[model samples]
Target chain A: MRVLGVDPGLTRCGVGVVEGVAGRPLTMIGVGVVRTPADADLGHRLVAVEQGIEQWLDEHRPEFVAVERVFSQHNVRTVMGTAQASAVAMLCAARRGIPVALHTPSEVKAAVTGSGRADKAQVGAMVTRLLRLSAPPKPADAADALALAICHIWRAPAQNRLQQAVALHTAKAPKGRTA
Target chain B: MRVLGVDPGLTRCGVGVVEGVAGRPLTMIGVGVVRTPADADLGHRLVAVEQGIEQWLDEHRPEFVAVERVFSQHNVRTVMGTAQASAVAMLCAARRGIPVALHTPSEVKAAVTGSGRADKAQVGAMVTRLLRLSAPPKPADAADALALAICHIWRAPAQNRLQQAVALHTAKAPKGRTA
Candidate 1:
């Protein structure tokens, strides 16, 4: 499976593509950041983000898009921007009918580093080692993106089974009735 | 001027269109809400919002788009959705090259009712009076949307002057120098 992971931010949205399935070696296809000027108008900034994300989608053609789920508990000042950028990334993928998944920060960290509380340096180091790169990707956001993709790839099997079970249960149940 | 206003929300996005400049009789061109199923995926909800906003834009051909500015200080559970919806609204307008303006709730209330802290009912009543409607727009969100458009129309003149002044100052100032 191929997945695109995004660490969404208004100033610097990190995106990385990883190709693999669970219990297999994953390959990092590409990783980069989409940047918007802080001084630009919000509308124009969103447009820029959309354009950048669209370009990435065109180039990568990943089957799934995984974005860091934004939580309002973060820095109040930056949380909104994170939510907005994530929305754009999700929209771009959903518009293309690519399944979109949201993984929390801790989930990403835990998947890659074996600890939910792993620091940025650990995540960077782990991503570098897992991808067989000589150095960690620049800008912690890029490393975080790769970690998110790795997490999604590792977790997809169970998630897919759970989804199938739910679908099967719903399909067998009576129509239009609450469970 | 014609302006389309949006009060962004995940479940119920209110939209309104108003026509006329400041200090003159204004016309309520349209007012309504765009709804999305709460159970739908976040990405699909955003796509629905984009389609809804685009439809309003297509129908009204508004010269400007006005959207409510979301603040994280509000209900924590809903603020993120509001931010995401507002982002989609802004993105839709920006993609069409329509000038987008964000008005705070207090600003909309103040523009119509002469008090920033005016209640929703008061703002709705004023919007009814300003537009000469027989009744307040249904759903407080709808009224708020109309209020936003009215505020944008009323504020445009002063905002334009400020923009022009800033532009003039920047042009006359030395290049590569901070203000």
Candidate 2:
């Protein structure tokens, strides 16, 4: 399956597409960043982000989209912008009928580098080796986007099975107050 | 000026439209809530919000859009959802070339009820009196939306002048080390 991963941000959003399946090699389809000037109006910046994502979606045609799930940050302004960008990514995928998955920063780190505490350098090194690229993608956001795609590609199969099992169990069980 | 105000929420988004100028009586053009099922996927819920806002913009043709600016909440999940919904509202307005303004909850209350710490009932009562309605609008969110529109209508002129003054000063100032 091919996945498009988005590292959502207001000033610089990362976009990367990877084609791969579980237990198989992956190919990098594309990677880039969409940037909006800090001085631009919020609405115009969002429009630029929306247009950038739309262009990437049109060109790569990924089956699934992965976005970084925003968590609480000390800086409310930064978090708000990230959340806004993330919603735009999800909107773009939903408009195209493409399923979207959200992965936490720790989850992506663990999946890519085998450690939830892995730093940027470790994650970048792993991504370079996994994709067999001579160099890591520029601007940490680009590498981070690829890592998100890799994480989803690796975790989705197991997650799907777990979801199926839960669904089956719920179907067979009766409504109860028990925890 | 015509203004569309949005009270951003995940489950129930309040939308209202009003037409008026500063120091003049206002007319309520529309008021309603857009809802999405709790069990629905995040992407689908956001899509519903996007569609709802798009429909309101198309129907009302408001010159400006006002959205509730989300602040940090104790509940991270709730705040994130609200922020996402707020982004969708801004995006819709931006796409239509309508200027967008964000008002804090306190700002809305102060503009309508003459107090930043006014309660919901007080704001609702003031909205009814200002709009010449027989009763308060249903759902607190609806009242808040109208309050946001009223706040923008009253504040925009002063805010615009301040912004223009800052721009003029910057344009005439030299790039110097002095503050």
Top candidate on lDDT is 1
Instruction: Name the lDDT value of residue A116 in candidate 1.
Output: 95
Interface RMSD of each: 9.4, 11.8
Candidate 1 lDDT score relative to the true structure: 0.84
- Write candidate 2's Cα lDDT for B1-179 as tens digits: 88899999978899999999999999999988887667766776788888888888888998788899898765777999999989889888876667778899989999999999999999999999999999999799888898899898899686745544543443322111100
- What tens-digit string does per-residue lDDT give for candidate 2 at A1-179? 88999999988898899999988999998998988778866776777788889889988998888999998665776998999999999988876667778999999999999999999999999999999999999888999999999998999686745544443443322211100
Q: How well is candidate 1 docked (DockQ)?
A: 0.26
* Candidate 1, superposed: residue stretches over 4 Å from native: A161-179, B161-179
Q: For residue A141, give model 2's deviation from the true position in Å.
A: 0.5
Assess the local accuracy of residue A8 in candidate 1 as a C-alpha lDDT between 0 and 100. Answer: 94
Best by DockQ: 1
Worst 10 residues of 1 chain B by lDDT: B170-179
Candidate 2, B18: how far from true, in Å?
Answer: 0.5
Scored by TM-score, the top model is: 1
Score residue A95 of candidate 1 by CA lDDT. Answer: 71
